[model samples]
Target: MENYHLTHEDGKYKLTKENGERASKVFESNKDEAIKSSKDFIQNQGGGSLKIHKNDGGFQEERTYPRANDPKKSKG
Candidate 1:
């Protein structure tokens, strides 16, 4: 599994996956507002989640990791 990063820029936002494929588009107004709107768009697609954090430098969202199977445990 891999993580992706979404960033806010001038009049638009950017999405970059771990594989390095990037997609960007222009929004109407503020960058932060655009980012939140984009997040909503993604969540509406299906069972998805997103979180925004304000770091010392700027805001960021950390993607969640799926649970892995454990072979050491026997079936009950």
Candidate 2:
């Protein structure tokens, strides 16, 4: 499965593939908008893993799109 990330940088939020230097999308809105857009983008790409980071530079959470695509071994 593909893995993507949503991170805060340069006063903007970005969605990028894992370890990518370039953003696939840039969120000019609030974090809420960034999260929603990232979810849609991942879902449209056939679902995948998304790692979200807090503005404090710490890991926030991880989401698996489509719900059913979540790994069986992980409960959270």
Q: Best by TM-score, which number?
A: 2
TM-score per candidate, in order?
0.40, 0.94
Candidate 2 Cα lDDT to native: 0.94
| Candidate 2 minimal-lDDT segment of 10 residues | 67-76
Root-mean-square deviation of Cα positions for candidate 1 versus the true structure, in angstroms: 7.8
| Candidate 1: regions farther than 4 A off | 1-3, 9-11, 18-20, 24-28, 49-76
C-alpha lDDT (0 to 100) for residue 8 of candidate 1: 51
Which residue pairs show backbone clashes in model 2?
Answer: none
Question: How well is each residue in 1-47 modelled by candidate 2, as lDDT tens digits?
Answer: 89998999999999999988899999999999999999999999999
Best candidate (score: lDDT): 2
Over the stretch 12-57, how does candidate 1's per-residue lDDT look in tens digits?
4555443565553335656567656655555444323333434232
Clash count, candidate 2? 0
